[model samples]
Target: MLRKAEDVLTTTDVRRRQVDERIRRLESRLVREHDEVPPSLVHEWIERASARFGDARVRDFVPLLVERAVRASVLGFSSDQHEMSGTWLPDWARNTARRLLADELPRRWAHTAGVARRARQVARVLPVEERDLLVAAAWVHDIGYAAELADTGLHSLDGARYLLRAGLSRRVCGLVAHHSGASAVAELTGMAEGLAEFGDERGRLRDALWYADMTTSPDGHPTTVEERLAEIRRRRGPDDPVVRALAINGDERLAAVRRIHRLLRRTYKPARG
Candidate 1:
C-alpha cells in the first residue's frame, strides 16, 4: 500500500505527460478556433519554466500554461490566470491551471493564486514526495469555478468532478475535489455528490491545500486565520455567502481553520517535514 500510493501520485510522470498532452490539445484547438497565441511563444515559456524548476520535465508545462493564458484573454478573464498559475512557479505547472481558473471565476482568480503561492511557501516544510501534489493542487484548487461548470457554486466539488471526468489521476483529482472542502459552501449550494465523491487522499496533500487556502488572503497575499476570518466578516458582512457559510457550518469552518493553522505552524515553523 505504501509503495502503491507513491506510484499513484503523478508527482513526476503523469504530471509531465499531462502537460505535454495539454499543449498538443490546446495547439490543435487554437488552430481550429483561431490563434490564441503563437506556438513558438508558448514553447518558449515551457522551455524557460522547465529550466527554472531545475527539472528538464518541468519544461513541458510552459506551453500548456501559455496556451491557457491566451484562452483566458479570449474569454475576457480579468483574473490573469497566467500570472496566478505562474506565481512562485518553479519552472513548471505554476501557471498551467491559470487559464482554466480565469475562465471560471476571474473574481476569485487572485485568491486561488494566493492559495497556490502559499502552497509554494509551505512546500519547504513538507516531505519532498508530497510537495508536488500540493503544488499541483494549488494551481488546480479552484478549477470548478469555471463559469460553465460553477453549477454547484462549490468550486471544489465541481472542479474535482470535472477533472475526474477528464481522466485525471485519483490523487490529483481528490486533492482538487476537497482541497478546501465544501462543507461550508456545500451546505448552501446543495452539492452532496461532489462532497461525497472526494474519497480519502493518500497523503497530506489535501490537508496542505486546505490549510494554505484558509490562511491566504483573497487578494493574493498572506494573512493569519484570525485576520482572514475577521476580513471575511468585515468585507462580506453577515448576509453574504461567506458569512452565511460560517453560519451554516456552525463555526466548524472557523474552528477547523484554527486547527489547521496550528498544524501548519508546527509542521512548517522549522521548515521541515
Candidate 2:
C-alpha cells in the first residue's frame, strides 16, 4: 500500500515545513517586486512578521496571512523610501512606536496620530521628499515616553537616539531629537550635550513638525496654539520641566507656527472663477 503523507513525517512537522516554504516563496516574490530594497531590510520585515505569529494557537493560513501583511509593509516602505530617502517611516517603525505607546500611553498615541493628520493636511505646502519626513517625525515624535526608552527622562533625546540606532535617516533623527523646541528642554534638564550630537535640524522641516505638534491637543484634536499651550500646562502642571521650557520657548515656538501658517496661506490659493 502507498505510504500516507504523515507516515514519513509527523503532521505538525509537515505543516511547519509547508509554512517555511511559503515564507521563502513570499520573500522571493517580494525581492522581485521591490528589487531596490536591500535584501537585509526585506528579510528583517519577514522575520518581524513571522515573530508576530510565533505564539499563536492556530497554524493554518497563518503563513499566508503573514505574507500578505509583509507584502503590504514592504510595498509601503519601498514606495516611501524611494520618494523621500530617510523621511519615509516604515510600518515597522510606526508599529514600534505604537507598541511602545498605545497600551502604556494611549493618550500619547492619540496625540501622535493627530499630529500625523496635521502633517498630512500641510503636505501640499512641503516638497515631496519633506512630506514623508514630516509625517514620519509626527508619528514617532513622542517615542521617548515609551517605557523602554525613558532612560534620560528626556523623550526628545531618547527618541532620537533610538531612531538613529534603528538606521533611520539623519534628518529624521535630528527632527525627533530636537522637535518642538526640545533643545530648550535639553538645556533645562542639562541634557543639551546629549542632544547636540543630533544637531539642530531647524528650518522648514523642523518648523513643520513643530507646527503639527503644537497645533494638536493631548486629546488628539486640532486646537489653536493658545489652547494647545494651555492643555500642555494643564496636563503637565505649572512646575513641570516641560512647562518651564514651554514658558521660555513659547515665543519662538509660536513664531514658528505663525511662519508655517503664513507659508500655507501664501502657497494655497483657493479655486475661483
Best by lDDT: 2
> What is candidate 2's CA lDDT for residue 108?
91
Total backbone collisions, model 2: 0
What are the per-residue Cα lDDT tens digits for candidate 1 across 127-172?
Answer: 6666766777777777776776576677787777776776667777
Each model's lDDT: 0.58, 0.76
Q: What TM-scores do the predictions have?
A: 0.55, 0.66
Q: Which regions in candidate 1 have their CA more than 4 angstroms from the true location?
A: 1-96, 103-107, 200-203, 248-273
lDDT of 2 by residue, 83-162 (tens): 34344364565787788999999999998877776776555567886777788888899999998998889999899999
